[model samples]
Target: MQACELNVIKYILFVFNLIFAISGIGLIVAGACVLSEVGEFSHFIEGRLLAPPVVLIIVGCIVFLVASLGCYGAIRESYTMLMAYAVCLLIILIAELSIGIAAAVYKGDFDSAMKNIMKDSLHSYNESRTDRLAWDNIQSKLKCCGVTGPKDWPSKTRPLSCCHPIREGAAPPQEFHCQDAIEGDQILYNDGCFDELKMKAESSANVLMGVGIGIAFVEVVGILLACWLASAIKNKE
Candidate 1:
């Protein structure tokens, strides 16, 4: 390639590196937010469930380091470094694709685990204060009743957390029966915690999947650019 054409490629690679750096920071933030959101329910779930966000964070950090190396390689016009950058991008591309596939495929396992956890928690609700509090918090926040419904509670009556229009410092509306009510009242939330939790887990996984795959595409472009630049520099030499 001509000198002017080579310069143009270098310029484009520099800009691409800058953008990739920003995207690295974005991935870090996204991963942290997702981790925080899902981590709230950590008490009820296993540690492996947190893998997606953690992997995202690791990938983001890798992206930062790679982007810096890419910038340095572009500035130095080092054919060797450019080739190394391309290899790094290829490795990242593989990782991102794996993460995306895992995120997409893991929801079924997540839902099954959620069901078992919720049921076990419900069975021990009266025996454990921690479980009781957790159930209350989950029902109130998710606008759900028991594992499957309010009837899923060990006792005939559901807790106040199942009531609609959850009050912070005060009681709910006088019309709705909150505590120790007959199942026939129909005042408790109808939705099941199982469904809600499954939906939320699936949603988070989808976000991770989408982000991983999208960045993987961008990394493909970077790999191409780096390889092209490396080849052109070799020719120019």
Candidate 2:
């Protein structure tokens, strides 16, 4: 390649690295937000259900580190660093492809597993105040009642959190007496917590997949640029 072409490749690699670094920061912030929002539920749910965000944060940090190496290699015209950057990008590409495939193949199983976990958490809701509060928050925020709907409560009564509009302009109803009318006349939320949670999980999975594919494409371009630059440096030597 000509000197100008080599310079162009180097600058492209540098820009890609900068984008990757920014993506890394995004992942970290996203993961932290997930953790913060989940609060106590993070501990209540199984690890697999919550692993993706954490994995994103870790992988993002790794990408940032690798991108830094790429930028430095390009700027310094260091053949060794360029080779190392190419190898790192290849590894990241393989890892991301594997994860994407695995996620697709096991998507159904993951959904089922998450449902079971939610059910277990519901069953144990009364065992701890923390668990109970978590369930209340989930029910209120998701506009859901029990794992399978209001029927799961088994006592023909629902928690106050399940009451839509929360009986405004009056004293709040008792904890489990929100539905004071005939069961048919109550204004309890009709959806199930499990279904609501499942929908959320699926949405999050899609976002993660999209982000992974995007980053993988960038990594491919970066690898190509690193390899071309490394070759040019060798020829000049």
Every model's TM-score: 0.89, 0.86
Which candidate achieves the best lDDT against the true structure?
1
**Residues 172-230 of candidate 2: C-alpha lDDT, one tens digit per residue:** 65665655533343567878887887677666677777777778888888888899889
Superposed Cα deviation of residue 8, candidate 1 (Å): 1.0
| Top model number, TM-score | 1
Candidate 2 vs. truth: CA RMSD?
A: 2.6
For candidate 1, what is the lDDT? 0.82
Pull out the clashing pairs in model 2: none
Question: Looking at model 1, which ten-residue stretch has the lowest summed lDDT?
Answer: 175-184
On the 0 to 100 scale, the lDDT of residue 217 in model 2 is 81
Instruction: Flag regions of model 1 displaced more than 4 Å.
Output: 165-186
- TM-score, candidate 1, is 0.89
